[model samples]
Target: MQAVDQPERRATPTIRYFVRDLDAAVDFYRQLLGFEEELRPNPVFAMLYRGDLRLLLSVPGTYAGGHALPDGTLPSPGGWNRILLQVVDLDAAVEALRRAGVHFLDDRPSGVAVRQVLLEDPSGNPIELFEPATGYHERAR
Candidate 1:
């Protein structure tokens, strides 16, 4: 009998979203998306996690050292870039979210190997939800 030593993985995937209203963003992610609030160290910031994904919600504009460029350009939300989340049932998920008053960019679920729906957070940050179908592929573990 032997026990093989393995290094513990500490680093996790993190995504920061500049939000208009921190509380609303927090609620949207926490309530609908299943993210658990991890930390709220300050008034303008919050950290949340769902599985291995760590989502950082931040209020843009001036603070102490602000998230602004040297030229005084403040960071803003809403962009084409998005985080993809896998779901078991795309139709059910979309229905539930829509019933909860969530917004979607595409009117219908569409994809080749996967059915997908692009949804927006309270601050308009895009998040893609996909359900793998026939011909879908993923790297072997």
Candidate 2:
């Protein structure tokens, strides 16, 4: 019998969102959030990165697995399943995004625990930017 060893993981994995229009999605994220393209699979595919987070975009028929949603068939308004981003300064982030012409749905401070701003991307995906309260730590189960 052979013994197997699992490799160690260093950092938290990133989430990838698929978009119908890769170029438009990439441009929106890069311009609105200061993320840069770290990789381009071709003219039709690209990976944008900000800090430790990553977003992959591709044109139709470019990626395998999950099928693409047809035009005009996306989820209805407020049907957004949001992606959360932890930032050091919530206000500054919101201001920058605002200056870039990004629409903000809400920018409210929730107690002293977090201040968050909700915004939607060109593809109607919602993203939440938040600042953690002081002395906060992730609890282990």
Candidate 3:
């Protein structure tokens, strides 16, 4: 969709989570979910990476992230929407996370084309783990 004269561009996928404790959030992502810490520039924020995914962790009501909106609404964590990570073995991953005392919304894997379990980070933001099933489908590269 671009002109040949223009350079190609790549955008990193990013998700910002408003957490209660930035340090704990950083630890949870880095230690539990296999994310590597990319930046911890301030007390209120951190950046983590897993593959092409860039995660931004920020404390609520402190940094540039969680300030109140013009309607007096403050951003908070714990929503239904979540980031889904595909895994080879969902049960093994869930078992390991269970051993580490991770909070899971549901550990019973269930899906049509992909089995999945939902778990929460330290701040209660949902993260889904899925394993492809017999009819699993993905776009061609």
Candidate 4:
């Protein structure tokens, strides 16, 4: 059998968040969420990465991804749907963020699976920080 050449591949998950202010969004992700800026092609678009997660920040009026529907409804930020980030110490993380003037929606324990705290980005996009409980594996089963 002859060997075949294969193209390189990578699996880095990405999510796009529509924001009103591109610079503010970049600062929030870079300083608070620990995402390093990957690229800023222009004023309208920027990319940030943390581990395997790539975040795309787009300004509604300038970026194509933030374009309105044919019905004339414009894209906007803020919704219950959110990005979940797993943390080792949920409480400590929450406290630190709170001290830095970040606002949290709530801080609660989700039974035995995980302890979660919800916060919003500058544009009001939700982000959940959770720490799995010690018995999380058992509860998951």
Candidate 5:
């Protein structure tokens, strides 16, 4: 067969979270979520990755994406929209984070498929940690 070419594609999706302090945000994600710092080109921006997730941390007023709008509305962190991370043990994770002085918005079990909790980064950006229900693996297969 003739050779075919395909465009390069990222294996993981990158989500950017606007932060007030880049260093603090980096510490929070790195220490709490186990995200490793990938690249930091400057003091105002950083890249973190864990598993297949890539998180871009940017300080407002420093980067284009974190810049204020034409209407003078500045993009800030903290919102209902959040990134969900799956874990094998929700209780253990929650306990560990709690012991580390992390703040949680809420922790509750869903109907029959998931147990999840919402926590915040130093920038107040929300992150959801979830554990699948008992039969989830069997059902998924």
Candidate 6:
């Protein structure tokens, strides 16, 4: 047991994804996932947030050039791998997305304990919606 003189440690922040177009990404995330714009550094970059999770959108030729995506490309390659969001109600989420004109490559699975649906955003980046089994929930680190 040492003396209580050291400062407390802070937890690391959550991972943030960078997208191609700031405005388009903002629009897509806002409409699709109900994400709100937490901050906008400039016209080139914006931060959209949902709870503790954050997404960063950067336009071409801004900040780190390598991080910016190609201009005029709806969904540029190598921008994103995939994003997965857990939902409390899979059916409602799926139905809502469907009504919003979102297309899914695979519809909601049938008779599965853990329901899942696969779809893409406006930029063609894939996203997976998951409703875990009754006893399972994702824990934050």
**Model 1 accuracy (lDDT, Cα):** 0.86
Clashes of 1: 0
What is the per-residue lDDT of model 1 for residues 1-141, given as tens digits with 9 covering 90 to 100?
Answer: 559764587679888888888899999999898899999888799999989999888899846223789897998889999988888888999999999999999848887778899999999999999898754575322
* lDDT of model 4 at position 50: 86
The C-alpha local distance difference test score for the whole of candidate 3 amounts to 0.87
In angstroms, the error of model 4 at 75 is 0.7
Q: List per-prediction Cα lDDT, in the order shown.
A: 0.86, 0.69, 0.87, 0.85, 0.86, 0.68
- Among these predictions, the greatest TM-score belongs to 3
Candidate 3 local lDDT, 29-109, one digit each (tens): 888888999888889888899999998888878754888888988899999988888888898999999999998999999
Considering summed lDDT, which 10 consecutive residues are worst modelled in model 3?
132-141
Among these predicted structures, which one has the highest lDDT? 3
After superposing candidate 1 on the true structure, give the runs of residues whose Cα lies further than 4 Å from its correct spot: 1-10, 63-66, 138-141
Residue 135 miss distance in model 4 (angstroms): 3.4
Candidate 6 RMSD computed on C-alpha atoms after optimal superposition onto the true structure: 6.9
- Give lDDT tens digits, candidate 6, residues 1-141: 877565477532444444566677678789878788888867777777777677666654446332434553332423436667878898899898899898787885643457788887765667778887765444422
Clashing pairs in 1: none
Summarize candidate 2's per-residue lDDT along 1-141 as a digit string, tens digits.
649664586654565565666677888888777678988867666877887777766554544222446763332223456778888888888778878777777766565566677887766667888887766555422
Please list all clashing residue pairs in model 5, or write none if there are none: none
Off by over 4 Å in 4: 1-10, 138-141
Model 3 TM-score (2 dp): 0.88
Alpha-carbon runs more than 4 Å astray in model 5: 1-11
RMSD score of candidate 3 (Å): 3.8
Instruction: Report the Cα RMSD per candidate.
Output: 6.2, 5.5, 3.8, 5.0, 4.3, 6.9
Q: Which ten residues in a row have the lowest lDDT in candidate 2?
A: 71-80
TM-scores for all candidates?
A: 0.85, 0.68, 0.88, 0.86, 0.87, 0.67
